[model samples]
Target: LLCQILHCLLILLQLVEIVLFIVDSGCSKHMTGNLKLLINFVEKFMGTVKFRNDQIAPILRYGDLVQGAVMIKRVYYVEGLNHNLFSIGQFCDADLEVAFRKSTCFIRDLKGNDLLTGSHGTDLYSITLQDTNCPNLICLMAKATSSQAWLWHRRLSHLNFDTINLLSKNDIVTLHAYFATEGIHHQTSIARTPKQNSVVERH
Candidate 1:
């Protein structure tokens, strides 16, 4: 009964080439991805697999527990196989239940809510899971800002407000002082050229 249900789940699962997994109840371990590529694999064990003609094939045990989105633990590694093998015994060990009908498989959570569903594939059942891409903490933060006073100082073509303030405080560049410094004896009504006053006239 367990094997039938698990087989249905595997047949219905949508998966890509990178994560093709076989649902094998007879297999002891939930075989994971390529052993040589996975960094977390440790504790290698020598396992022997028997085939139809009593042929035995040596297997390597690379056990790992996959949690979060799809929860499975103690998965092995098979070198030559194109797909990983999921063990129904492991699912039973985890106390999870699978239901199948109408060529579809449904995995339920502890509360009896449907966790995942998969449609039947053409040849067999294959499960495909969704992957999420989220931004890290540093990328979500806003950039730092500069002071308004410093911004205005630069916008005025590097005019030094400190020097201007000092001159005004001491009355060094008052109206009379400015006129005398510029060598203008009296105020003259001089008209500025159109091009020179164009920017001021726009406002």
Candidate 2:
């Protein structure tokens, strides 16, 4: 009975290791302690970071997290970082718009196109991003449709394109690429500009 209980505890620990990332408006870049989550990782001397708990961690290198067709590029490595983090500032820098409701987080391209959706936990917009190469999925987030995006939009408070520019980062490009691979066209053509063709829209 003791051995069985130990085994059960080990399994539960493994299950809880599922990456829990907080979408942080305060953080400047995506950060994670698990180097295994990164691909094409490059070793370099970056710097150090002071976590919210007043504990400090070292930033060793940077890499990309390739998921399906999307690559979250330039994720910084902070060994034993207190918590995995998604940077709203970084997302905003990439021309992505982020909005929050009571329990759902919405990410969109500037064209009002949905890119990613995350659920809100007690105090964090916890977005789980799975690593494609790993056999065990770390962060398992929901994949959404356009209607889902509109639904979340209706739930948001006073924020909108007219009021806020939203989160960003270069990774937004890879996300857009992922959408393209999935047959979701986000680009529209300019009027009277026949040379610029528009991609067909799919439901």
- Backbone N/Cα/C clashes per model: 9, 9
Q: lDDT for model 2, on a 0 to 1 scale?
A: 0.67
Candidate number achieving the greatest TM-score relative to the actual structure: 2
Clashing pairs in 1: 10-125, 11-125, 11-126, 12-125, 13-126, 13-127, 14-126, 14-127, 14-128
Best by lDDT: 2
lDDT for 1 in candidate 1 is: 33
In candidate 2, what are the lDDT values of residues 1-203, reduced to their tens digit? 32232222211011223566788988989999888788898999788899768888778899987654656778999987868788998888888898999999977889987667789877779877654444442332333354464443444343344332221142212435545577755554645423335633365
lDDT of 1 by residue, 1-203 (tens): 32232222111112223345555557676665466324356666668665556666666666554323654556666555556666667666777776666677666767787755555677445555432222222211112234443444344355355754564666543544654665645433646523345432211
> For model 2, which pairs clash?
90-168, 91-167, 91-168, 91-169, 92-167, 92-168, 93-168, 94-168, 94-169
Candidates' C-alpha lDDT: 0.51, 0.67
Off by over 4 Å in 2: 1-17, 136-203
